[model samples]
Target chain A: MKRFIGFIRKEFYHIFRDRRSLFILFGMPIAQILLFGFAITNEINNVNIAILDHSKDTSTLEIINKISNSKYFSIKQIISREAEIESVFQKGKIKAVLNFEKDFGRNLIKKKSAQIQIITDATDPNTANSITNYINAILQNYLQEKNKSIQLDYQIIPQTRMVYNQELKSVFLFVPGVMTIILMLVSAMMTSISITREKELGTMEILLVSPLKPFQVIIGKVVPYIFLSIINAAVIVLLSIFIFKMPVEGSLILLGAESVLFIITSLALGILISTISDTQQSAMMISLMGLMLPVILLSGFIFPISSMPAPLQVISNIIPAKWFIIIIKGIMLKGVGLAFVWKETLILIGMTVFFIAVSVKKYKIRLD
Target chain B: MKNENVIEVENLTKAFGAFKAVNAISFEVKKGEIFGFLGANGAGKTTAIKMLIGISHPTSGKAKVVDFDVYTQPEAIKRNIGYMSQRFALYDDLTVQENINFFGGIYGLSRKAIRQKSKDSLVELGMHEISSKLVGSLPLGWKQKLSFSVALLHEPKIVFLDEPTGGVDPITRRQFWEMIYKAADQGTTIFVTTHYMDEAEYCDRVSIMVEGKIEALDTPKNLKQQFKVASMNEVFLKLARNIE
Candidate 1:
């Protein structure tokens, strides 16, 4: 145990002595949280748009006033001809164009329905999709008011509520994801690079040939990273809670426990990577390409797994971050208990055990 | 099986899927002798040293390092021996003092002992002023010397030096050999592997490996006399040329 402590002290020295890595370890989480919190938002405000109204009527003007007054959109131009719509969009100042068909108010009053085309530039599909949804809801509200005086028969009204995120704040969805990514990268990438660095510098051979057991050597190398990762997870959670106002409704202890489990899972993956890699460069490449990209792209951090294709969804199940994100979101947003997150917790535990077992076996083989 | 012998091997072999890397080699070293392991590149010198150091297991043979069985008692073997590898084995990011303390601590030395040893080593090497400096900032010769010193900090019965003097100047190499001789004089068996034939002359007994086998084993003088050469370099070349 004393020797193990010595080994860990050496590891801490290595980490603290390198300023670049220290920045990457502590600064990245805060920087990323701030960047993701204040920037990269889905909420739209003062969006530039063009209005094409064929009917110069009170009803058309009223609807335009409502859209511009909602603060979601700003009227950039009014085009008289349809040919001018294409040219306005070519300038790229406007993201959406609102078009009302000819005789819009006359038809809505006589026929009880009027067609309006919401033309949006799909160059950025996410922004376009949100813009269309917002406009559709506004039109629906206007129709509801219009039909309140006229008794329309056989009408079905659908009510939808965003349960966990009431205000639809994108930061609420991304805090857990960004925390997972930072923890994974720090624990896995840093540990793998550090271990492979020992191999490259021949210090690994010296440690292996010492009285330190292979298990001891590996644990010593990983313990410091586990502590660092937990600290990183805490900082990210605190930033999200205080700065971004993301709530942690469930037990903080359970959240912390699950985070430590995930950190161990990632550290085990790092040991597995170091066993397979002979140099620090190769270990870094494997950690970045094999671990980071998959965690970022396929772990439902930025994309929903349910909406993904079948094969990608199946592949995502193997990523521990997916389960961790689910667990964290449950605890933070839905205020779920351990009973609610037991399956994800079990999966993470199982993966941690499997990774550690495999890495130990591979490390022994390499030593022999 | 002599009481004074620190290393014992009998027909140790390591093979990698139909290719033998160390083909049935056997040798022994006494407690306080300087044993040189010489080979050309890929001549299995490293493979043999790795097995002896308890890192690599031999495919088929019996070997003991510092009286511990290499197979069953590798941990015991690890506790009794020190290893300095080819690539300057100290942590470059750590201070010289920290490196010494770290290595000393891992060998289960007491903190007081570590402090005393660090002081003695720094003063002995005339590097007391630079003990707090980062090892990476030091010159290559100093790093190699410090690595050797750290490897011996635990006062192990045997020390394995795998190409410890690869890229240093001749003066540093000579100084390094003097350190090795000083340790041997203190009754620590030294097993060193080197590609430099001139360095082999300083060893009490030298073994030259050719194609995964020990082609010649004798004193540098006896090997030269038996091979009818004036220098150890000619002796190594004559043995290497016979393989092709």
Candidate 2:
């Protein structure tokens, strides 16, 4: 145990002394969280929109005021001619164009219906759809308020509520995913490269020939990474809680335990990677290409796994990140206990065991 | 046991699929003897050394290193041996003192012992002033000598050096040999492999390998007289050329 502690101290010196690694380990996580929080958002806000109202009536003015008053849309341009609509959209800043028919208030009073066109730029389909939906919701609410006293037959109204994230904050979704990627990159990629570096420099031969057992040497190399990754996890959790107001509804202790388990699983994967790759470059390339894309796409971190094709869904089940994202989301957002996340917890444990077993076997084979 | 041999091998052969790298080679090195294993590149010297060190398994044969079977008691063999490879094997990012401390610690040395030994080793190398300097900043000769010292830090029974002086100058090589002699005089067996023919003369006994077989094995003077050559280099060339 004293030898192990000494080994860990050496590992820490390696990490803390390297300025580039220290920056990447600590600086990148906060930057990623802030960037993903503020920049890449699902909630539409202040979308530039153009208005083309042919009827200069009080009702059309009131409706336009309602659309612009809401936080979703900003009236960037008001075009008078019908031909200007296409050109305004071509400029591309205007995401949606609102056009009220001529004599809209007169038609609403006589026929109880008026035409309004919500033309959206379909190039960015998601954002365009969101802008159109926001406009429709605002119009529906206005009509309901205006006609509350008049009873009408066959009225249809839909009620919807965003269950888990009531505010639909993108940070809540991105924090967990970003945390997973950063931890995996830091723990697995860094460990693999460090180990392969020893091999390339010939220090590994000396280490193997020493009195230290192979397993002890491996554990020594990886233990410091576990501590660093835990510190990283805590930083991410604190950032999300204090800055983004993300909740930790479940037990904080369970969250910490699961994070450590994921970190170990990643570190084991790093050892397995180093065993297969003879050099640091190959280890890094394998970690990035082999692990990053799957974690991002199939882990339900950025993209929903259910939305992917069946084959991809099947393949995603093997990615450890998928299970970890579920575990974090359960603990942080849903506030679920161990019982609720036991399945994902078991999957992570199983993966950790599988990786350690494979690495140990490969390590033994190399010695032989 | 007073005449204990640090290394013993009998018909030790290693095969990868159909290709044999080291074939039916047997040798022994007595305690405190500088034994040289010489071969041209790809003559299976490395393969043989690896098996003897218990890092590689032999296809068919038995070997005992430091009185422990290479197959079943590899850990014991490892504990009793030190190794230096062709490449200088110190952590370039770590200071000299830290490298010594790390290696010593991995060998299960206590912290106090590691500190004392590190100080003593650096002073012996006349590098006590640069103890805190990163090893990457050290010259090649200094790095090689430090690596050798680090290998022997645990005081193992045998030190296997696989081409330990491949790229250094002759002066540094001579100095390294002196260190090897000093260690051997202290009762540490020096099992070394090298391509420098002149270095073969420094060994108490030498074995020349060709095509995975030991072509010649004897003292330098006996091999030269047997081959009727003026020098050990000529003898190695004659044997190597005859094998081809």
Candidate 3:
């Protein structure tokens, strides 16, 4: 136990002495949370769009005023002819164009329907889709306001309520994913790199020849990373709660325990990576490419799993981060306890055990 | 248990499929003997040393290190032996004192003992002033000597040095031999491998390996006389060339 403690103390020394790695371990979590919370957001605001109104009537003007008044759209240009619409779109600032047909007000009153074309630039499909949807919502609101007195005999309105994130705040979605990613990267990458560094420095040979058991050495390398990654988890949680005003509805202690488990899972992966790789560069590359890309893309962190193709959804099930994201979301957002997240918790524990077992089996006892 | 031979091997061999890296070679080292294991690079000097140190398994062998079977009691063998490889083994990022303490602690030394030994070793190396300096910043010779000292920190029964003086200056190499002699004087068996023929002279007994086989084994004077050469280098060349 003293030897293990000494080894861990030495690992801590290595971590603390390297300023760059220290920064990577502690600095990245807060920075990523802030960046994801504030900078890289999916929320649309002040989108530049052009207008083409042929009728120049009060109804068309009123619709245009309503669109511009909402924070979502800003009318950048008004075109007289349809020919100019393509040219304005080619200039590329305008993401959409609202085309009001000729005699729209008269047609609406006489035929009880009129054409209002929401022509959005499909170059950026997501924003274009959002722009089209926002215009449709605005038009629907206008119609509802105008038809307030004309009640239909049977009307069914779909009332939707966002359960966990009531405001639909993007930060609420990002904080959990960011925290998961930071914990994974820091725990897996740091432990793998530290282990491979011993191999690179040839200290592994001395260590292997020493009295220290191979598992003791591996665990010693991983313990410090677990401690640091937990601190990172805490930093991300604190940043999300304090800076972003995110809520933790479940037991904070349960959240902490789950984070530690995930951290161990990542650290086990790190030991496995170090077992296979011989150099620090390869260890780092394997961890970043092998772990990070999947956690980011396939874990449903950014993309919703339900919307993903069938095979990708199946693949996402294998990614531990997906389960972690689900677990934490259940905890922080849904305020569920272990009974709700026990299945995910079991999967994570199983993966952690498998990784540690594989690494132990793969860990070299001889320099063959 | 009171046997004079600290290391005993018979028909020890390590083969990778059909290629024998260390052929069926047999040897014995008396306690406190400085046994020089010499060979050309890739001649299995390292492979044999690794097997004896319990870091490499032998394909077919019978070996006893400190009365522990190489195959059955490698863990016990590991605890009773010290190893210094050609590669620099100390952590460069760690301070001088920290490396010593860590390795010392790895060998199950107590905290107070590690501190005392670290101070004494640093002072013996005349590096007490730079005990706080990172080992990476030290020169190559100093690093080699420091690693040797660190390897012996546990005071194991046998110390294995695999080409420990590969890149050191001649003066440092001389100092290294002196340290080996000093350790042997204190009744520690030294099993060392090297390519430098000049270093072969310092060993109490020497073995020349050529293509995984021990072509010759004797004291330096006896080897030179047996090969009808005036120097250990000529003896090695004669044996190596004849085998080739």
Candidate 4:
């Protein structure tokens, strides 16, 4: 045990003394979180729009006022002709164009309905869809206010609620994803590269010949990573809670334990990678290409796994990050206990065991 | 028990698929002798050394290193041997003192022993002034000598050096050999492999491996007389040509 501690101290020296690695370890997590939180967002706000109102009437004016008052759209241009609407959209700042038919209020009074054309630029579908939805919501609110004195015989109202994130704060989604990426990068990539570095420098042969057992050497290399990864996990959690107002609804102790378990699982993967790669560059390439892509795309960080093709959904079931993201979301968003996350926890445990077993077998073969 | 040989091998052969890397090689080193293993590149010298060090398993036959079976008691063999590879194995980022302390600590030396050894090694090498400097700042020759000293820090029964003086100058190689002699005088057996044939002349007994087999095993003087060559280098060339 004392020898292992000494080995860990040496590993820490390697990590702290290298400036480039230190920068990557701490700087990347915060930058990624802030970027994902502020820059890349699903919620649409202050989208530039144009309007072509042929009828200068009370109803059209009131509807325009309603759209501008809502936070989603900003009236960038008021075009008098239909030809001007296409040009404004061609400029690319205006995402949607609203056109009210001639004599809209007169038609509404006589026919009980008026046609208002909503034209959206379909080149960027998601933003166009969001702009259309926001406009519809504003019109619905205006009609509801105007119909306060009269009761309609036929009406349809749809009620919707966002459960886990009521405010739809993107940080709540990004927090768990960012934590998973950071833990995986630091614990898996760093440990694998460090071990392969020893092999490249020929120090591994010396260590193997020493009195220290093979298992002891591997444990010593990974123990420091576990500690550093835990510290990284803590930093991400604190940033989420304080800066983003993301709450931890479940038990903090269970969250911490599960995070450590995931960190161990990642470290085991690192060992497994190191066993296969003889050089540091190969280890890094394998970690980045093999692990990072699956964690980002297939783990349901941005896209819903259930909505993907069947083959991709089946492939995602084997990714450890998918299970971890579910565990973290359950704990942080749903305020759930161990019973709710036991299945994910078991998957993580199984992956950890599998990685360890394969690596141990490979390591023994190398000894032979 | 005290008179037992430190290393013993009998027809130890290692094969990879159909190709034999080390073919039926057998040798022994006494408790305190500078045994040399010499060969040209790809002559299976490294493969044989690896098996003796218990890192590679032989496909057939048996071997005992430091009185521990290579097949079953590898851990015990590892505990009794120190190794330095062709490449310098010290951590370049670590300071001279920290490198010594780390290797010593892993070898289960006490803190006091590590400190004393570090101090003594630095003083003996005339490098006490730069004891706190990073090893990357040292010259290649100095690093080579330090590596050898670090390998013997735990006072193992046998120290295995695979081409310990590959790229250093002759002066440094001579100094390194002097250290080997000092360790051997202290009853520490030295098993070293080298491509420098002149170094083979300095060993108490020498073995020359060619194409996965031991072509010659005797003192340098006997090999020169037997092969009718003026030097061990010519003897190696003749045997290499015959194999071809």
lDDT of 1 by residue, A1-368 (tens): 88888889999999998997899899899999998888898777788999999997988998998898897899989999899889988999999999999999888878766778899988988788878877776777776776787653323232242333347688988899999999999999999999999989888888889888888888899999999998999999898889878878999999999999999999999999999999989999999999999998999988878889999999999999999999999999889999999999999999999998998899778767
Question: How would you encode candidate 2's per-residue C-alpha lDDT over A200-267 as one tens digit per residue?
Answer: 98888878877788888888899888888999999999999999888888899999999999999999
Q: Could you give the DockQ of candidate 3?
A: 0.80
Q: For each candidate, give its TM-score against the true structure.
A: 0.95, 0.94, 0.93, 0.94
Give residue A223's lDDT in candidate 3 (0 to 100).
80
Docking class of 2: medium
Q: Which stretches of candidate 3 lie over 4 Å from their true place?
A: A55-62, A102-113, A143-148, A152-168, A364-368, B1-3
lDDT of 1 by residue, B66-165 (tens): 8889989988888888899988888889999989989999999999999999999889888999999999999999999999989899899999999999
For model 2, the local distance difference test gives: 0.89
Query: Interface-residue RMSD per candidate?
Result: 0.9, 1.1, 1.1, 1.0
Name model 2 segments beyond 4 Å from true.
Answer: A55-59, A102-115, A122-126, A143-168, B1-3
Q: Count clashing residue pairs per candidate.
A: 0, 2, 0, 0
Note the residue pairs that clash in candidate 4.
none
Q: Write the per-residue lDDT of candidate 3 for residues A1-368, one digit (tens) a residue.
A: 99998899999989899997988998888789999999987667999999999999877987899999999899999999999988998999999999999999877666677788888889988778767766766776777766786542322232232233346477989988999899989989988999999999888989988988877888898888887888888888888899888889999999999999999999999888998999999999999899999999989888878889999999998899999999999999989999999999999999999998888778754355
**Best candidate per DockQ, number?**
1
Candidate 2: which pairs clash? A249-A335, A250-A335
Model 1 ranges with Cα > 4 A deviation: A56-58, A103-106, A144-166, B1-3
Tell me which of candidates 1 and 3 scores higher on TM-score: 1
Candidates by DockQ, descending order: 1, 4, 2, 3
